[model samples]
Target chain A: MRLISLTAIAAITAFPLFAHADDRIEDALEARHGYMTMLAINMGTLAGMAKGEIEYDEAAASTAGANIEALGNYAVSDLFIEGTANGEVDDSDALPAIWENPDDFVQKFADLGEAAAGAGEAVKGGQANVGPVVQKLGGTCKVCHDDYRKKD
Target chain B: MAEDQARRVRIWDPALRAFHWLLALLVVANWLLGKFGPNIMTLHFWLGYSIVALLAFRLIWGIIGPESARFSSLFHHPRSVTGYLRDMVKREPSHWPGHNPLGALAVIAMLLVLIWQVGTGLIADPEDFVNVGPLANKVGSDIATKADAWHALGADLILIFVLMHIAAILFYRIWKNEDLIRPMLTGWKWVRRR
Candidate 1:
C-alpha cells in the first residue's frame, strides 16, 4: 500500500513537468514560426509595391517595413534553432542544410536583417525612398530561401 | 463460367474518375499559373473553389457510391498496406479490385491536404497586395497572416506529394509495367488473368 501511494505520487509529480516542457516547446515554435513567416511576408509586400504589382499606401508600407526591421531584433535563441538540423518541429522550411552550413545561414540571416533595417529606414524617410531599399531586401530573401529553404 | 467472370470486372465509378482527372488538371494548372505569373491568380481562385466543391461532392459520393468507390471498401489495415508494398516490390499479382491500400492512403491524404489548404486560403491574407482570400476579413489579421503562411506551405507540400506520386506511377509503369496513369485517364484497366 505504501509503495503504491509512492508510485502514484511520483507519477503525479512528473507528469506535469513533461507536459509543461512539451507545451513550452510547441508554444515557442508556433510563436517563432509565425514571426519569421511574417518577416518574409512583410518583405515580399514591400517588394511588390516597389515592383508596382501592389499600389503603395503610406501607412501600410511604413508599418510593413517597420515590422520587417523590428523582426531583426527578435532573439534568435527564442526560436527552435537546434531543430533545423533534426526536423523536430516544422517551424521553418530551413532544411538540414542550414545547420550543415551554419556560417552561410547566419550570414544570410544577418544580411536579411541588415537589408530590412535599411528598408525600414527608407520607408520611414519617404515612400519614394523605399523602392531601392525593397529591392535590396527582396534579393536577400530570395538568396536565403533558394539556398537554405528546402524545396517542396 | 470462370472465363465469363472476366467480363464483369469494373474498378472506378464514372463520377469518381471524372473528379480524379478534373482535380488533377486543375491542380496542375494552378501550380503552373502560380509559377508563370500573377495574372492567372484569378483563374487559380475559381479553380480552387471548384476543387473545394468537387471535394465536397466526393465526400458525399464516397458514402453513397458503388462498392469500389466507397471509402469503407478501399481503406485497409496497415498490415495490408505493408503486404501490398511487398507485393509491389516483388511484382506479384494483386487480388483486391478497388484502390490498393497505398493508393487509398494517397487519395485520402491528397483530399485532406487540399481541404486544409483551401480552408486556410479562405482566411489567408498575403498582405492584401495581389491576393487576399475570400474570407480573410472574418479572421483577425494575426490569424490571417498565420493562415496565409500555412496556405503557402500546404500548397508547396501538395506539389511535393504530387511529384512523388507521379514519380511512383512512372516507376511502376516502367519498372513493373503497371501503366497506372492510363486507367485514371481512361477509367478502364487492361484485362488481367484471374
Candidate 2:
C-alpha cells in the first residue's frame, strides 16, 4: 500500500512538470519578440531626431537614452531564457558558437549591456560627454559581433 | 615573309586607377593614425567619409561607366575563379584586360565590405566620448551596435586581404616576371606583340 501511494504521488508531481514545458516556449517567444519591438522603437525615435521631425531636448533625449539602457536587459533576459528552453528556432541571429563559448559570449554581452546602460545614464544626466558613452557601447558591439555574427 | 609586331594595351582608366591607389594609401594612413594618436581621429573620420563617397561613385560608375568597370563584367563563375587560382599556384597566372578572376573577386569583396564599414561608421556613436558615426542618430542603438561590430571586423578583414593581395602581386612579379602594379599606375600592359 505504501509503494502504491508513493507511485501515485510521483505521478501527481510529474503533472506540473509537463505543464511548465509549454510555458517555456511562450516565455522564449515573448522575450525575443519584446527585444525586437524595443529595437524598432529605439531606431524610430533616433531617426525622427536625425530627420529633424523631433527636436533634441534633455527630456526627449533622456527618454531615448533610458530606452537604450533597457534594450540590453532584453538581450540578457532573452538569451538566458532561449538557452534554457533550447527551442527549435535556429533562425535566431545568434550563432551556435555562442553556446559553445558560453562563458565568453555571456561575459561579452554582460559587459556590453553594462556599457550601454552606462551610456543611457550618461545621456539621462544630460552629460556633455556623449562621446565616451558612445565609445563604450560601440566597443562592446564590435567585440561581440567579431566573434558571433556569421560572415556571409 | 617574316614580320615582327608589338601590341600595346590600355586597361584601367586614369580616374579609377588614381582613386584605387590613393584610397589604399589613405586607408593605411588612417589605420596607422588611429594606432598612433587621437589627433588624427578627425582626419580618419573624414577619410572614411571620403572612402564612402568614392565607393558610392564607383557603384554608380560600375553601372554606367566603361565596360571593364561594370559589376556584370567583374564577377565570374566559381569554376573560372578556381581555374585562375590553379594557374596562379602553377606560376602561370593569366592577365585580363580588366581584373583577373581572383583579383576581381577580391576587389568587389573589399569594396562591399568597406562600404558596410563606412555606412555603419556614419551612425556609430561612441556615446559622445570620442566619436559618433555621422548618421548614427538615424539608427537605433541596437542597429548601431550591430553595425559597429561589422565595421570593426570588416576593417580587420580588409587589412588582412590587402596584405595578401600585395603578397600575391609581388610573388607574380618575382616568379612570373609580371608587372601587375605597373598597369594600375600607367594604365598600360605590354604583353606579346600581335
Candidate 3:
C-alpha cells in the first residue's frame, strides 16, 4: 500500500514535466509561426515591387528591406530547439535533418542575415536595384530549405 | 564466309540514335545542374524543359519509329523475360534482334520515371513563394506541396534507375561481352540475316 502511494506521487510529479515540455514545444512553434508570418509579410512587399506586381514605392521598399534584415538577425535558437522537429510536432515543417545538422542549419540562417543586410542597403536606390536584391535574397530561401525544411 | 552468317545492319533509325545521345547528354547535365548548381537555376530550368521535349518526342517516336526502334520491338513475352533471366544467371546470353528483355525493362522504366520527374517538377512549389514551378500558380498551395514531395522523390528514383542501368551495361560488357552501346552510337549492329 505504501509502495503504491509512492509510485502515484512520482507519476503525478513527472506528469507536469512532460506537460511542460509539450507546452515549451507548442510555445516555440507558435512563436516561430508568428515570426515566419512577419517575415513573409515583409518579404512579400519586396518581392511584389521586384516582380512589378505592386508599383515600386521607395518608402515601402526601404521599410521591407530593413524589417527582413532585422528579422534575419533575430535569435532563432529557441524556436529550433531539439525535439521540436516535424516528427515530434505534427504541425512543424522543420525536418529532423535540421537537428542532426545543426551547424549547417544555423549557418544557413546566418547567411540569410548577411544577404538581407546587403539587400537592405542596396534597395535604397530604386526599383531596378530592388529586383536584383530580391533575387539574391530569394536564392538563400531555396538553398536553406533544400536541406532543413520538410517538403513544401 | 563465317562472317557472312551475320553482318552489321542498319537497325536503329538515325532519329533514334540522335534522341539517345542528346537525351543522354541533357539528362547528365540536368542532374549535375539540378544537384550542385542551385545558383544557375536558369540553366537547370532550360535543361529541364529540354528533357521534357525529348521525352515528348520519345513518346511519339516510340510508336512510329523503325521496326527496331518501335515500342513493339521492346515487348518480350513474360516467359521470355524470365527465361532470359534464368539464362543470365547461368552466364548465357541470348541475342535479340533489338533490346534484350532486361534492356527493354531498363528503357521503359527509365522513360516512365523521367516522365514522372518532369511532370511533378512542372507543378511543385517549395513555398518560399519565390522558387516555384512554372505551373505552380495554376494549383492550390496544398496540391503544390504534394507535388513538391513527389518531385523530390522522383529525383531519387531517377538516380536509382540510372545506376541500375549503368550496372546492367557493365554486366553486359564484362560478363556477356556484348557491345550494346555500339548499336546506339552507330545505328548498326551485327545480326543474323532475316
Best by DockQ: 3
What TM-score does chain B alone reach in each candidate, compared with the true chain B? Answer: 0.87, 0.87, 0.90
Candidate number that wins on lDDT, 1 or 2: 1
Query: What lDDT is reached at residue A135 by model 1?
Result: 58
lDDT of each: 0.72, 0.66, 0.82
Q: How well is candidate 3 docked (DockQ)?
A: 0.49
Error of 3 at B96 (Å): 1.7
True contacts kept of 1: 0.00
B89-108 per-residue lDDT for model 3 (tens digits): 54533344677777788899
Pairs that collide in candidate 3 are: none
Candidate 3 has a TM-score of 0.88
Tens-digit lDDT track for model 1 on A44-148? Answer: 677667656678777778888888778865666556456533366654555678767878877877886787674555776555666767656655665665456
- Give the Cα error of residue B149 in candidate 1, in Å: 0.9
Instruction: Identify the candidate with maximal TM-score.
Output: 3
**What is the interface root-mean-square deviation of candidate 2?**
8.2
